[model samples]
Target: MIEDRELQLLINDIFEYYGYDFSGYSRASFKRRVDRLYQMDGFSSFPEFLSRVRVDEAYFSRMIEEITVNVTEMFRDPAFYAVLRNEIIPVLATKPFIRIWHAGCSTGEEVYSMAILLKEANLLHKSLIYATDINTNVLDTAKSGVFPLRMMKTYSENYVAAGGREDFSNYYIANYGIAKFSSELSERMVFSQHNLVSDRSFNEFDIILCRNVLIYFDKDLQDRALHLFDDSLATLGYLALGTKETIKFSKMQEQYEQLRKEKIWKKIR
Candidate 1:
């Protein structure tokens, strides 16, 4: 286990060595991840681990990737997507152009899922899905629109639960050990590396889904991210969070209206 003082030293060192900021993230999560890396690398001492992080750029990249490894899937919460498919899409469809940002998009499962939703709604022609993650490796995975073939069964089940009617297999071509989604869906997606902690809003969006990402941040960092989302969202746009996330007590509660059944908020003010 990484001691609190040692963790602070690492956080400071990482920020000074690399521009990435982990200071705002949850200490427990950071310590756990860093400790896992330390053990995996067979470091005998904290000094040795810190030195490896500081001196070897490649090891640092590996550390970032391991520390921020994201676990995500398509239509993660069926009811959430059901709400979007049945209610949210209609409202977004009225817009001249739909801009959706998948902030902290791990490996693009949800991004591709959104594209499928737009395609089903007959609005894919004008919808642009911008998917961003802090980790470049994951961004590259998302850019390729490929996922493990074994996971398709689970994703297909999620698709149906999310109100999808078409045979989900039609959306992708599976071969060997991977599934590659259609180019039609990928055509409208733009993938990039974006750091939610320090990066400012790039464009106004009708819908911004940062799902399952904010829970890892501390209260102040959560507020900062919510503020960024508020700035980036359009006047009547929606902000979606993970099932465990909420804005009820935060500063965003006054500006956004929460949905009755989901973790989504509409920017009314």
Candidate 2:
């Protein structure tokens, strides 16, 4: 609803008021999301939205949901999971215990995906998955592990392509147009709210999967996140990203070896 500079001021106000920093997000996509929020809320100007945000905490929560990207599904990018199952899990299985961080895990689909893979490999019982998201609402959703049954068909296709050996339907029970994934898959998973932009790394992980999340960030924020991952990972730990996201030009690129078409990388230095 206004020039980019004015919109940036609004973003700054949000940071000052709520401690949620969005200034490092990609400008074009951020503006588009903000514009959609403004239009949907019937705000006449950016200041109007800013005024509401400063005064209303709930409004700020809604803004965070709108501004942050959350597009995800079960076993997204099947080939990536295939590579992980074929090339990575075996190595991790040798560890006495495993710590996996699913950063930016929106609604927990892929967390469950990894859990299932670990279970099949006889590694789930000894593995701990820290699934974190910036938004608590989605973290709650992920905790519940319920999704629309209509999505099962698509997810099932992805499951097979990802080298699933059993019927995908076995993982969930269907009722009332929704499917609730088995709690067995969630037993070892911990879902929490974590801000990759500002939060410090909490644990050294054997594997970190942060797919499709950084494309929304500006270069500086992306580098900040990459550095965080670098610090959080154990030597020779794995880093998995979205297909479109890469470490090729990152300052830490040389510290990693790209594996399986760049969808996965291993920290070498």
Candidate 3:
């Protein structure tokens, strides 16, 4: 395991050299990720691992891919999607155009899911979903709109639970253990690399979803991300987070109103 001091050193070095700040991430989670990489790479010592990380750009990229959490799947938290369909989409439909930002959108399963929702509501032609992640590797996968064929069963179940009525298989074409989603869905999505820790808010959005991501950040970073979302979200627009994440105790809590038992919040201020 990497020592506490050594983990801090790694965080400092990464920020100084790569301009990627992991300083505000949860210490335990960050340390565990680094240690996993350190062991998997068979580094004999901390200095050796640190030395390689410093000298090799490709290795640094590899380290980043391993360290940043990218675990996500389609229609995660079916109930949340149900709420979006039942309560949120109807209101958003009143607008001329809808823009949504998916921060830390790992592999973009939810973004695609959102596209399906808008399509069902007949709002896809006027809606654009911006999906951003820190890892370029995951961004590429998200852009492809391809996923393992085996995962479709669960995703389809999630879709139904989220109030989807159409045949889920119609959304994708299966080929040799891979399911490629329709171009219609991918056309409305824009995937790019974005670091929520250091990046500025680029556009106003009707909805911003950064689910299951803030749990990895320290309070300072979590607050920072929430503020960015607050700035990016249009007044009265909604911000959605993971079940365990919230803006309730943050400075922005007063500026937002939670949507019942779900994690969605509307920016009232």
Candidate 4:
């Protein structure tokens, strides 16, 4: 069994070594993930586990990937895309140039979804997307824009339901049971590694999509992230979140009006 004090030391060591702060993450989830790592590595004690992780860079990278959850899909929660297409794009169409940010974009599915949507709407040429995540492994996967071809049938249905005009097959080439998305879609996007917990905001955006990534954080961390979004958004800029996540309890709630239940919010000032 790993002692609490030893767990703290491990956490501190990770932060000091990698500059990735897991300190603000939920303790229960963090501990559960670490425990799983211990069992997988056959370590009976936390100290031994910590020493092994510290000494092995590849193992440490793998452990970070294990600890950071990266679950996403193309056109996830179709309704949110529906809302964006119906409610947001019309307004965005009026802008001369648009800058959108995808914070904590796991494997780039959502980023590709947005890019396809913008292209279909005839707005892709005018749009610049910044897709960021703390996990470099996931970011690299996202940059590849390759996904399981078996999943495309379901994704195609989502695309249509979200008001897609063209055939979904137009977006990618299918080869050996994998779908490789077109470079055209990726050309408009800049995928990079960014830690929302420790890094400051980089650019003001017309729209920010940070879905399903905040639930792992505590309220204080959530609030801090929201504040960063608030600062990074232009006046009346749009904010999108996961179905279960919301700014309702944050200090920024009053400053942004709920555009689509808890799915989207628009900064008022």
Give the number of the best model, judged by lDDT.
Answer: 3
Q: How close is candidate 1 to the true structure, as a TM-score?
A: 0.98
Number of the candidate with higher lDDT, 1 or 3: 3
Every model's TM-score: 0.98, 0.97, 0.98, 0.97
As for lDDT, the candidate ahead, 1 or 2, is 1
Candidate 4: 10-residue stretch with minimal lDDT:
254-263
Candidate 3 — worst ten consecutive residues by lDDT sum? 248-257
As for candidate 3, its clashing pairs are none
Candidate 1 residue spans exceeding 4 A from truth: none
| Worst 10-residue lDDT window, candidate 2 | 254-263
Please give the ranking of all candidate structures by lDDT, highest first, separated by commas: 3, 1, 2, 4
RMSD of each: 0.9, 1.0, 0.8, 1.2
Error of 2 at 22 (Å): 1.0
lDDT of 1 by residue, 1-269 (tens): 77899999999999899888999999888889999988888888999989989999988989989999599999899999999999999999999999999999999999999999999999999999999999998888999989999999999999999999999999999999999999999999999888998899999999999998899999999999999999999999999999999988987799888889699999998
- The true-structure Cα RMSD of candidate 4 reads 1.2
